[model samples]
Target: MNTVIVQPTGITPADVLAVSRGGARVEISDAAMEAMRTSRALVDDIERAGRPVYGVSTGFGALANTSIAPERRAELQHALIRSHAAGIGAPMPAEVVRAMILLRVRSLALGRSGVRPDVARALVDLLNAGITPWVPEHGSLGASGDLAPLAHCALVAMGEGWVLGKDGARVGAAEALHAAGLRPIELAAKEGLALINGTDGMLGMLLLALNDLCHLLTMADLTAALAIEAMLGTDRPFQPELHAIRPHPGQGVSAANIHRLLQDSQIMDSHRNDLVHAVQDAYSMRCAPQVAGAARDTVAFATEVAARELVSIVDNPVVLPDGRVESTGNFHGAPLGFACDFLAIAAAEVGAISERRVDRLLDVCRSRDLPPFLTPDAGVNSGLMIAQYTAAGIVAENRRLASPASVDSLPTSGMQEDHVSMGWAAARKLRTVLDNLTSLLAVELLASVRGLQLRAPLTPSPAGRVAVSMVEPFAGAPGPDVFLAPVLEKTRGLVAGPDLRAAVEAEVGPLR
Candidate 1:
């Protein structure tokens, strides 16, 4: 019911997240509308004065030099939309389509794309009415601004594509718009190009991934702390002063968060002066701050990159207010693509370490007296041995999926779109990695919770206790011969819940 107005300079990840989560509405400012109007007027003047514009007066891609007659320009725009709607593969989920709509509207709202105000309004109306266009998951080379996928989005505005309605009904875009009392947007001059040419689709995936990764990173911290407590590992590895000397922002933040999570913990200090003679734990347990911190740093960088792109007008052949049209390459997705790959690598490592921790929890020798698979009847039940296998499978899958997509490219549009970034592939793979990592964390959480329960009356660190209490309601205490899949799924829901992160933060305070 609340609306958040985003000015050109005031967009934040929190604002975007709020909008994406359906808690807030997005509205553009009057200055932004004025800019769009000025740009549109320039486009009209150019078309009337018979000037040669790359996308306005000519065909797109390899046919950029071919001129369109004045009378058929509108037809040209319409044809562009209809012909380019060639998206393939499974349809993108509704949340992603909603994010794409929000991001694209924000970009055009910056007013440099030469799109008509009505076109921008149509996109906003669709968002307000919950009309999500059926955008497919494939068919983008990632060089020309996610062309095919975005065209599918533009088709809905023209009343030709499919839309998912409020009550979960599938209907034609025209009927959906008519039902909502909205009219189809008309393309004027550069409006078609503006609508279809941008990094919004790829960026939408990245934004959603970033939101999930933020939660995952915090979950990783909590899981790592639980694993450390289970292993009775020394807390010296996360000492704040030790991290301050090296001074990597992410490492320091990670160390502080882990230390906070383990602070005032009778369990963590229980093994501090014990006769336990182990020199040090494995890298997965001892170097958790370093590994998790690196991922956190990458996420920080990727967040900045995505935020910078949110307000950028990325369409080509931009129309200036002085009636000048200049051809450019703002449609390239390389920047966001590189960030997406980086995020995948980072998130993949989180899964890798989590799988290792799951292994540690399963091994009786490493789990500090916890029963094998934390089950009393391990021989008959086989306990959580298979859960570790599932975690390892997902971790290996993440490694394959995290292979940098930006490194591969293929020519399209007869070499006019040569040297593509494959950004959509990178974004898609990042989402996959996020899912895989979430599952991995869920397994780790289930194992850690089981291990913590074995240490029952030995109260965990204050932070770990809070985390355990949060998931305990959903997962319950693991018993012998129980089906682990339901428990794992419930653990995942807890990890994905908004309150989990808030609970962890409340217990541990700001993560430095």
Candidate 2:
């Protein structure tokens, strides 16, 4: 992949994926360098004049009022990072660490954090050299700027903590830097504070989740289309004029996608005149667009927030261009916390509705004459009945995970840092919810595709046929149950991937 040249203003979620997961190189823009230089000069003047700045000459949090001597100032910065690097629990994935690093660099590059140009350059060098800092999952209260987690990242910059080497093994920061021909940065006034004070961790996870959901939502629409065709459900409810009356942009988009996917379907045409068929399908089959479209809308809202955060300068004491150093609360993770929780709720609903569809596909009575559990021999084989159970269990878990972490606050730093934003917790739970959602969608795809095969002779829409073909290699033809778990697992990969969507899009233009 080509390098992602990050300017202060144009870093998209796509750019984040490139650097975090695709091994893309990074270069700081010249304009950003100039901004950093200007901020550094202001910090220099503040330090020389012996003015007690909150994070520069003075201490932090509860210690903000306590001034430090000139000689001990740099030591204060070093100690701040070391003490705060007390994060516990398993380390975050390397991709998350890379995103955190990239976001931190972006925030510092905006030139309001008052860090020297060398500090930003060192961070970029670490990313370009593929050295990922070992940051634990815990220790971020999501307020006072993800202090513990980002501190772990800052520790590696000073050659103190550990890093994942190029071979993906852990190594001391000093050894990794040496091998990469990199040097550690010495501490300067407000530099350490700048490094560890931001909402990067929570925002990074949110960005990643947002990107994943963009694909997942479309897949949901495709899978919904497959379910509707398999169960002989009508697509009239998804018509544009019907959707326009209640006009949620996401709803309209989702309904259109389902309508387009089911266009020219022979299965619906074959059963178009069946007198015994019900007037409307169940909510799970009929209201797929409404539920999934709401999620699409939520993802769009979260994307806007993530975009603003990408260019935002988040630090405790911000340095303005007019040479004023002031303490501010821009580091609070409440916005990200709310967004993550909201997405989790939206994702959970999508999964819940999908599981309902899965349930309908397996129940013979509800499925309208399909085989019980989709097995050839109903009594001899259990079939994919348990798959519905698994989806149900995951959907239940998502409900609990969707509880807002932002609503819960605990005091820290001896009450000086009270009312923390558990945004990191919210972000973490959001990841789990999205993961479960992928698996949930996978189970639905498996059931729907199997149900589609039983209705063979009566073919699906062009788009639904494309979806079926994409998963056939993993899902296989319907038969008496044989080691069903592996098939479902493999189908999950297809549902959670781009190939299925790519195939459908290739034939039907594109889905919303």
Candidate 3:
């Protein structure tokens, strides 16, 4: 990937993904650098005037009324970062922290935070050097943005925190910076506050989840096609005309994808005229496109929210065009928090309906005469009975996670932040929800492919064959049950991957 130029505007989800995961380099545009200079000059003039401002001269949070002399103003910034680095729990994923750093850079580059140009450059350098700060999972209520988490990221730049080592172990920030041919920065005036006060953490995770969930939603359609072919379910419901009346964009797209995947299928062809084979399939079979399409729509909605947030400067007390430094609630994470929780609900429902499909494929009566539990000898070998159980357990967990985190608010900073967004917690839960959805889809894929294999004389669709080919190694020939854990475990990795979609898409053009 080429270097991502950070301007005051035009940042996108793709840029974030590139820098966060694709190792793309970041640079501030000349226009942005000039804007920063202009903004900083105003701050310099304000500091010289010796007037009380929310972030520049006075204290922060509950102590905003406390006036400070010029000499101690630099110390105030340092102390803000140090005191707010109160996060506790396991460290966030390396990608998440990298994304947080990238977004903070973007915010500063927007020239609204009133920080010197080097503040943004130092963050860019840390990202280019791959120095991931150890940000704890907890501590952000999401009102004044992700304080504790971004504070940890700020601490690394100040040479006062820990970073992930070459071996993924925790190493001192000073040592990591020195090894990376970088020097620590001393934050002055509003620089440290600018670094930490934003919705970067939750917003970054939300973007990552949307990226990953887009693929999983595709897999949801892919696996649904596999189950339809394996169970000899009819594709009449997926007809373009049937979906045309409803006119939901995602529903039509999903229905078309399933229709394309089911083309030239011997199974669907054999039962094309056989009326009693399945009069009308169950809702799980009939509504695969509906459920999966809803998820795709939710991803679209969340992506829009993330897109707007990507270019937005979420810093407090932003520097205005009129040379006025004023405090604002632009740092509230409610928009992001609601988006995160909404996607989780959508993903969990996809997993919910996917679990139902797996159950149908396992039961002999419901599976159109695929063997009980998908084993050659039903009574002796337990087969994939427990795989469904594992999927069910995950689906249950997803239900609990689906409860919106945005509504659960607890005051922090001694009620100075009386209401919180809880967006960070929602973002964390969304990651787990997507993880569970991937595993559940894997279970469906494993069981449904087994069903396809049992019906040997009747061949499946070409895309179905490609799916079977992918899972065949883990799911050997119709036989007694081996250690099923490793099979499902490895298959989960496959479900989370892109190869299956690529192979199927290669055969059938492309899925939605």
Candidate 4:
């Protein structure tokens, strides 16, 4: 009988992830309920007063000034859902759809959207009952607030669109609603526009990508720690005083995390014998914290922007308590659009440095006495030679995707809706960058574990040993190089899962 309630003020990136992962039940607050009531009352008063209102008593887009007859109001609302539900692309992954539903619910529960309480309750009911609508992944220009993608979702409330059932099969939305003992919510004043016009599509993707990036940054820190140990690099660059002077939050956090991970490593100490034989290590080994820290800082900035966007209502022709229907640009996606692009660049940088470590690990001359390509018989067995090639390719692709999506804008809706934000493109690229970084870090993990094996009997630090143990079970030592593709895939899975991340954090403190 334990329930976790999320108020507008209390929701975080972690909370979004928990709800998307089906880890908790969600409810709107009583205060939120009252706010929704007040808002809806104002909308009714406006309609009763016989005033012009956008999207309520009138048509949408280029037809915004065109008024509808009183008798056809219901028809107008229904047509909004049908015509705007023109999303044309592959189906969005179930997780992203769930996130969109949850985000839309949270925004409405803030009580500024003028939607009826029944509409809010229906969204919350869908989240609790796990009836996610089948939303297409594309067709949003990110202005007019992701209309197409969200309309496809809003169709479910009208007892239309596809629904994913508990058994993993698609069914009619009406059937799912009936099975859950619910009915199609009647569209009240401004309800249709409130349901479909918001930045939920881009916001949902950003929420998911941000949550993953937070964890991936921690994983990157751990991977960099292992790479540092393997390369026998100096830790003085991460000294607290050095980072304190400049004091970028992410840099300080990364430096501190790396220092703690390498705290007890004897191998990290200045070695006279190794120093005489070797000069300085490569930039990948030496500047791990600085590069990784910048990416972490960018993510922190984006998280702040996204968190604010989530709680605030982004609907248009918003109803005020004073009975004024004010049309504003709050629905613009520029803020979220820019934040997602910035995060994409940040995540791509993490992949860039991790790929360098993979390269260094493969080069026999650079690797300081490890066998060529980490294969004892370099000529016969290719070992991890091709693995670096894969990592390099991924990193190169990440660079291309890192270009800012917000910088590009196009006119839409016959020049009436000019200057689109392209927020969806930014969110999409951020997700891609995250996937590439995961594979890149996995390659680094594999190479570091192999490097440690080659330098065996020379024990790694406690934290490194824990990281190695988490991945080692999934990937055993490569002997004579049979197919390594599976090993690499397993390593990627190990690093990406929450369990292995938890294990690493247990050994080394939180990599915040």
Candidate 5:
């Protein structure tokens, strides 16, 4: 794989994915190296002047007023990293830690952290050598820049903490570094602060979550189309002109997707002129565009926030070109906190609406002509009945997780770090919400595909046919349930993976 170059500009979420999950290499640009050199010179000048800088000379947090001698300043930076690397609980995923390293390197490359080029290069080398730091998941306040987690991440580079080896065992950082043929660097003035004082940890998780949701939301549109066709619902409500009256970009896009997905459908054509059929479908079926569209808009807003964060230099006591360092509140994570909470709400709502559709599909009275629980033999075979319950349970959990973590704050660092942003909590729970939604959508898809099969001689839309064929191998032919957990697990993989979406897109083009 080609190396994902890091610089002051043009860092996309795809780059994060590439470095974190794609097994790609990374390199810092020459422009960034020169900038780091200039900034590092400025920091050295400030040290020579002997005036106390917030992070460069003075103590941190509650001890900011204390001054330190030039000889002790380097020791201060090392102590800061050691003290702050107080994270607890299990280590974060290697991919998350890698993205944190990548984003932190990119932030330092912006030339505002006043660290040496070798400091940035060491981070890159660690990433290339696959020496993932054992960063704990629990110790971030999401303010003052995910201090604890980033400190733990920085600990690996200082050769003081543990790291995950290639065989997945936790080993000493010194051993890991030696095995990779790289030696750890001792702390220099402001280098340790620059390494750990960043919002990169929380931001990395949020960016990856945002990217994953983009694909999942598209899969949602495709799955919803399958359910609508399975239920013998009309697609007239998805007309572009009808959606145009509302003027919501997400709504119009979702409506257009359903419109394309339902084209050339014998199933829909069979019911077009029937007067006895209900004129309008339920809100879950008829108003899918509105629900999923609103969720799409939410994701778009979060993406915009992540984009700004990608380019931003988030640090305290940022270095200036005029040979001065200033302590600033840029390290606060409120923006990412709100964005993560907002996306969680949207994901929960999407799952809620999807579960309702699943309920309607399983309920005998509401299913139009399909049998109860989508079983061919009624009570004798309770096919997929419990699946609806599972969806409901997961959706309920999402609702609880959707409660905004940003709104709740607790003072930290002896109240010197007061008014912290709980962005890490929001990001962590959002991951759970997104994961739960994948399973819920898979259940809905499985149920919908079964419902379509029962429609019999009436062939579905081209896109619906493609979706059914993609899911059938895991879900198996429509019949009484036999060992449903394995099938549902496979179907969940089908829903979460790119295969089902690729099949649908091959037939009906890409969904919104």
Candidate 6:
């Protein structure tokens, strides 16, 4: 993997994933280095002025009114890091920690936060060295920008906390730093506040979720398309003319994708003019684009929010270009919190609708003339019966997880930091919902492909045939349910990626 260069310009979602999940190195640009130096001078000037500043000279949170002696200023930074590293629950994944560190590093490099260049450089080095910090799961209330999680992340870099070993055991931070041929740097002046006060954790999760959803949503479209043909339903609702009147960008795109995928289909032609099939399909088959499209638009909106956050200066008492240090509300995570919540609900809706199609495929009454549960021996095999149940189970779980975390809040930091964002929880729950949705879509794919195969001489669409090929080896022949868990798991592995979409797109041109 290539190194991700950090500079005054900006970073992208791709750069974040590269460093976080791909183990890529980071390099700070000279311009960013110069900017950091210039900002640090401004902080030095403030300290020499002997005036009280929020983070540089005084205490934090409810203690903001207290004045700190110059000698104790360094202790303030250390204390802030140590005290705030009070996160609980299981440790965060190494990738999540890497993303938090990278985003924090990017913020410091922008020259707004008054921190030494070495502070940012040290973080980049740690990222490159792959020495991930042991951040806990349940620390952030999402206010003050993931303070607890970021604190734990920064702690390992300061040689005072814990690191996750290769085998995921907790190791001494100092020992890890030494092993990596790196030394931990002490936080100076307002550096501690700058390091921990960011929306990096929630924003990082949102970005990763967005990338994953992009592929998964496309997969959703394909799976929905397969289900429509597998159940011998008409594709008229997917026609471009029908969607153009609505004018929603996502809806139009999804409609066109299904319309194109259903082209040159022998199965659709088999029922094209038959009075035998219902004039219209059920809501799940007819309105997949409507639900999935709304979800796509939601993702678009969240991406806009994440993009703006990428360039935001989210530190307290930031160094202004006009030479003044001022506290700010930019660190509030409401924007990111709202975006995460929106995506979570969208994931739930998509999964719920996909589960409907999965159930339809297994229902002998609704699945056209297909056998009950797609089984050769109905009552004897109970074939794929619980598979629909699994999809239903996930859809129900997602409904619970879809409840917005950002909507809830509690007072903290002596009530000075009240009205928290809870964005971290929102983002965390979004991840789980998306995971469940990936499985839900996989179940749909498994059932639909089996439904199409059960049709025998009645061929499917060209794209649907390609989709069957993608899952056939893993799906096996539509038969008795012989240990179905591995099959669903294998199909989910494909459903969670771009391979299925790519394969179909290769033959059918492209899906939206």
lDDT of 6: 0.90
Pick by lDDT: 4 or 5, better one: 5
lDDT of 4 by residue, 259-316 (tens): 7887777666535246643346678876777888898888878878888887777888
Put down candidate 3 lDDT per residue, 55-121, tens digits, no spaces.
Answer: 8888899999989889999999999999999999888889999899989888888888899999999
lDDT (0 to 1) per candidate: 0.82, 0.88, 0.89, 0.80, 0.87, 0.90
Shift in Å, residue 316, candidate 1: 0.5
What's each prediction's TM-score? 0.95, 0.97, 0.98, 0.95, 0.98, 0.98
Query: Candidate 4 at 66: error in angstroms?
Result: 0.6
Q: Count the backbone clashes (under 3 Å) in each candidate.
A: 0, 0, 0, 0, 0, 0
Q: Candidate 2: global Cα-lDDT?
A: 0.88
lDDT of 1 by residue, 215-305 (tens): 7887888888888787777777788899988877888877877777777777776777775733577899878889888988998899889
- The TM-score, computed over Cα atoms with residue i paired to residue i, of candidate 6 is 0.98
lDDT by residue for model 5 over 1-512, one digit each (tens)? 56998886637788899999986899999999999999999999988888778888888889989888889988999899999999888888888899999999999999999999999898999889888999888999887988988888788888889997656678999898988899887878888889887789879999989888888887788788888888888888999999989999888988899888888988888887775553888999988889889988998898889999999988778998887788888888999999999999998998999999999999999888989999899878999999988998998899999999999999987889889899998998999999999999999889989988889888999987886787777777778778888988988898788887877888777676
Q: Give candidate 2 misplaced runs (Cα > 4 Å).
A: 8-10, 165-168
Model 1 clash number = 0
Which scores better on lDDT, 1 or 3? Answer: 3
Question: Which parts of model 4 are misplaced by more than 4 Å?
Answer: 1-10, 165-169, 269-274, 277-279
Q: How many pairs in model 4 have backbone atoms within 3 A of each other, for residues 3 or more apart or on separate chains, i.e. clashes?
A: 0
For candidate 5, the lDDT comes to: 0.87
Model 6 misplacement above 4 A: none
lDDT of 6 at 57: 97
Candidate 5 segments exceeding 4 Å error: 166-168
